[model samples]
Structure formats: C-alpha cells, structure tokens
Target: MLSIKVLGSGCANCKRLETRVRKVCADNDLDATIEKVTDYQDIMRWPILSTPGLVINETLVSQGRIPAEAEIARLLKS
Candidate 1:
C-alpha cells in the first residue's frame, strides 16, 4: 500500500488539502494510507519548507499549495 503524508498545522488550507487528497484517493480507487503530520518537527523532517505538503511513500511530492486533482491522482497512481 502507498503511504501518503500531509504536513500542515491544521490550517484551513491544510484541511482543504486533506479533503482533496481523500477525494482523489477514493475517486481513483487508490489503496493508500493517508496520514496527517501536524507537528513542525515531523514536517521539517521532509524537504518541505512550507505547509500543506504532500509526501508519497516517503517522497516529497508537493508543498505550499494544493495540487490539481489530476496531478494528485497521477501521484497516487504512481
């Protein structure tokens, strides 16, 4: 299974990103576990310097902004 991590501090953007990620996973029938990382230290562990980051199986994929659904689906598929 894929491991997906969303790093944020429980902000609105973070919540929105999580919602989008969940929808993308469901719509694409992706078999992945989604985890929310709110701790600053954990977020910093990744190569992300911004909130609302997306990490897939330990690979940092996106940060700072929400990605398009298509892009997210592609990431999840990979």
Candidate 2:
C-alpha cells in the first residue's frame, strides 16, 4: 500500500487536498494509507514551506497549493 500524507493546519485547502487524494485513491482502486499531518513540527519534517502539502511514500510531492485532480492522479501513479 502507498503511504500518503496531507500536511497542513486543518485549513480549507488542506482538507480539500486530503479529499482529492482520497478520491484519487478510490477512483483508481489504489491501496493507500492517507494521513493528515497538522502539527507544525511534524509538517516541517517534510521540507514544506507552506500548508497543503502532499507527500507520497514519504516523498514530498507538492506544497503551497491545491493541485488538480488529474495531476493528483498522475502523482499517485508515479
């Protein structure tokens, strides 16, 4: 299973990102563990300068903005 993390402080964008990740996983039938990292310290460990970060398999894939659903699907496949 893929390990996915959405790093943020529970903001709108953060929630949206998490939702998108979940949708992608569901649509593709991908097995993934989606986690939310809200603690500042925990989020910083991923080298993100802003909230709404997306991490896949412990790798930082996005930050600072909400990505499109198509882009998210692509990321998951990678």
Q: How high is the CA lDDT of each candidate model?
A: 0.93, 0.93
In terms of lDDT, model 1 sits at 0.93
Residue 12 lDDT (model 2) = 91
Query: How many clashes would you count in candidate 2?
Result: 0
**Tens digits of lDDT, candidate 2, 1-78:** 899999999999999999988998999999999999999999889888988999999999999999999999999998
Give each model a TM-score.
0.96, 0.97
Clashing pairs in 1: none
Q: Pick the candidate with the highest TM-score.
A: 2
- lDDT of model 1 at position 21: 97
Cα misplacement distance, residue 44 of candidate 2 (Å):
0.7
